[model samples]
Target: MSPSTPQRPRTSRRTLLTALAATPLLSALGTGTARATAAGDVYASNTDLYTRLPDGEGTDYARRYRRHEMADASTEARFPFHRTTVLAPHGGGIEAGTSELCLAIAGYHPATLERAQADGPVHDYWMFEGIRNADNRELHVTSRHCDDRVALALAAGSLNVLSLHGCTAAQAGAPASRPEAVVVGGRNTDFRRHLHEELRAAGFRTVDGAEVPDLGGDDPDNICNRTLLGKGGQLELTTELRQGMFGSFTRQGRAKSTNDTFRRFTAACRAAITRLEAGPDQAVL
Candidate 1:
């Protein structure tokens, strides 16, 4: 993985959000622009920057709580490496369901990365790294820590990536009845449509451009859209659906056990990916 970028550090929550909302479009418009730095130890540049730290709370808690050690690939093997990448940026503890989904979808794919806890809990993105995969390459891990490496692997080529993230229904202003909805985003039209269709066919609701215009994945720098090939897909699964998949509401890294919903959902995702790889002539939907 490549080294992290150095730039201006963030001052406050408002400033951080403002930078996030503005940087993508600005990056898309300009060929070469200035980079933004993150506040404190963490450098916020791409898709892996979010946490429970409130406005006033300092990074002390995050610093003291998280253990920043790269995993030993040989001991803690997860998935092999392939051209297709599956990532759970907010895995470990930042987001509850992401790591599980990423691993479930990865199945036997050699190119999958998830943040797993070694000793204690870890929400720090900069510290996350992957074991050496089938390709014998370790992921640079955090975008802030190793943007260049990740860029080369996923963002710089024609690689297809599937990113799983966790979102709240209340945050999206979704109706109570649609708690099992998975909001589809990213620039890959075919993959996005397949995700929506597969999720719906698996008995889950979907919210896309028609319902949530703001989360339409138009931003070029978004981790999902940052694929080297051109575009990729992002799935923001709701808390309810995640809970159904894991059969609990814990913030643990991986599920100790899983439910039928999890199996069905993963199967649907795999089937969609299979069809996607089969080319347009073999598209199931």
Candidate 2:
């Protein structure tokens, strides 16, 4: 039998209500009262940006997600429900290669939007992308402040979350001589270790996020850590690393062209998730 409509068995009514109530207040404050990051972001939260921007999806911005259904009684004996989720809050032009990486890490092909492997595991995913002509950086909503209802609900319902982000080599404190690197952060120590090991094994440079004070994703409120286990992992890829993953680093190019580096990185991430899922920490969501 085919899978039924996606179920959100873990998103409680209280959680939805709390998210709905908090979003509008932030949006209503407008840009004036919104806290500006060191990068000079104007919006307080995703709700603030969504309220101010034109309602033009597929043009200015887009939101996409997928939550696979649980197996029925007949299939449950053979298949297990995926408890992990991958996220890209600053995808498309905002962070370049993150959107593509998010899809690939969640078991989909970035170019074709199909399952990367026929019998491979497919985890849940959610991405908010900026498809604008220019100035997409203004759309960024930091992870701690990301209040998109769907993103929140999806995260709340999952046991693990793997959030993807892009950062400058300078921000990551990578040596100028060799700048291609990824910083692994978030509150989940086991998840972070797995990611670091897998990425290093795949020939990618990995850094401890604690070395960069600002990028340390240890905040309990950060979206990636707001999972069923109340902890998750975050990967911050440097610009050099992200750019090398695509042949032409434009919005259109990212969707159609991904090189070997991209494949290797995604494969490493999936391997880490698989390790986490099979480990003893696989909490019931």
Candidate 3:
């Protein structure tokens, strides 16, 4: 996958939503002039995403934590890098995005939407939503700290459209597309790999590669906050483009309070995990 527009390509949640809400005529605007837009971090290209400190900005907060770093490769779609950041001792643990981790796997992730299309037909988009109540450390076997996401979006795709993640404090009031399924992703490789396995066992499909394809249209569903990331050994989700899911810049205006981070639904997550860990066709709905 060649790099998208040498410059920083943006995919704002607010902008897309605003456009979608404001310009209802795009779908019928055949030229796609209003909608045939392109997204950055396109299906895995050369890119770098870093995590932020919990206390939010400044050197003091910066001193408290560091971004998890590994390697960089904007390779393919299943692994669309959205550039994630976090605060506190939270979002850490060998995870990508949240704690300051780099591309978790080595080299370019070797899956392409085009290749997948060649292998088989690419079709509809499948979205998933979940919450990571535990911190990267807690989930990945570390003993330091924990974190909570009022909401979390996971990556999983079938033919054409890969999953999209509008999950975060930034996306709080932003317009977001609803997902088809929701699966949690943890910090460690083993944990994530295990989770993927469990999801499959529960009858949900996951892409073997890390790429999410772009189904062109007025919507042009490309990956956004597309995949889970690792930072300073911590984990967090990221978007495909810095462009907001809500149209405004990620750090724009007074930050909106994030929705309830999964604390109230601990039982639900545990139950979901248990079900996946335990049975064959337990149903993940």
Candidate 4:
């Protein structure tokens, strides 16, 4: 709980995707001392969350359109177009099944060419998770609440990345947007010296966010570090045993850590699921 805690300011994208569509992603990866207070979290506020970011291949077709609203006791009813979008990455390669206009709410999921390797000379540090909502499942950002939001997508040069974007802090989550740290220098200095030697082989004696200005640093392996990292939920993610070979991945306290800031976000979740598998076949207006 250092790095000058108490964050949540530079936020938008509809309040960090509506707090990552109403938080979940494994309780924002929180644990152990609340995961070091979510690695020094932060995120102000504004609320944009984006709505239109289209490209090519159109097939728009879906209808069930309806409208109605009424609130009392004070008033808080506003639903013209709920606007939804889970995780949308792209770079070609995503058309398993889609196309029927689904940005009006949100729909798309295609990312399975994953990779993970590390035994003795480990250094790839992989953690890709780009899941989204299929056509706004009853809004409020559902998917059983975004599987508790967990992000980590990095793989530049050939492209296809994801990372640290679970969003929260509307009330009590943390890191509202992303980027509080992750600024290693020199043309990718070997992917930031292999992420600081994979956290010094995972012990975390002390890494310091670029010398510690506010507590947060370089996390981009590529893909222009996408936005909407969790709000004030802080940070989390860990797995250590090796003592008894519980899950063994190269013992020595097998560590991989984060608090906030680590983006690439799988090219916007494969360009919003290849634009909904290509577009045109949806009907629910």
Task: Go through the candidates in order and give each one's C-alpha lDDT.
Answer: 0.50, 0.80, 0.23, 0.22
Q: Give the winner by lDDT: 1 or 4.
A: 1
Per candidate, the number of residue pairs that clash is 11, 0, 66, 65
User: Residue-wise lDDT of candidate 3 within 149-168, one digit each (tens)?
Assistant: 21122222111111212222
| Native-referenced Cα lDDT, model 3 | 0.23
Segments of candidate 2 deviating more than 4 angstroms = 1-39, 74-79
TM-score of each: 0.60, 0.84, 0.21, 0.17
Please identify which of the two predictions, 1 or 4, would achieve the higher TM-score against the true structure: 1
Q: Between the candidate structures 2 and 3, which one is better when assessed by TM-score?
A: 2
Candidate 1 lDDT over 20-123, as tens digits, reads 56633211101111121232223343333222112212321111111124444686555322335566654434445556666667662112334332331221
TM-score of 2: 0.84
For residue 140, model 1's alpha carbon misses the true position, in angstroms, by 17
Q: Which ten residues in a row have the lowest lDDT in candidate 4?
A: 91-100
Q: Candidate 4: count the clashes.
A: 65
Ranking by TM-score, best first? 2, 1, 3, 4
How much does candidate 4 score in TM-score?
Answer: 0.17
lDDT order, best first, reads 2, 1, 3, 4
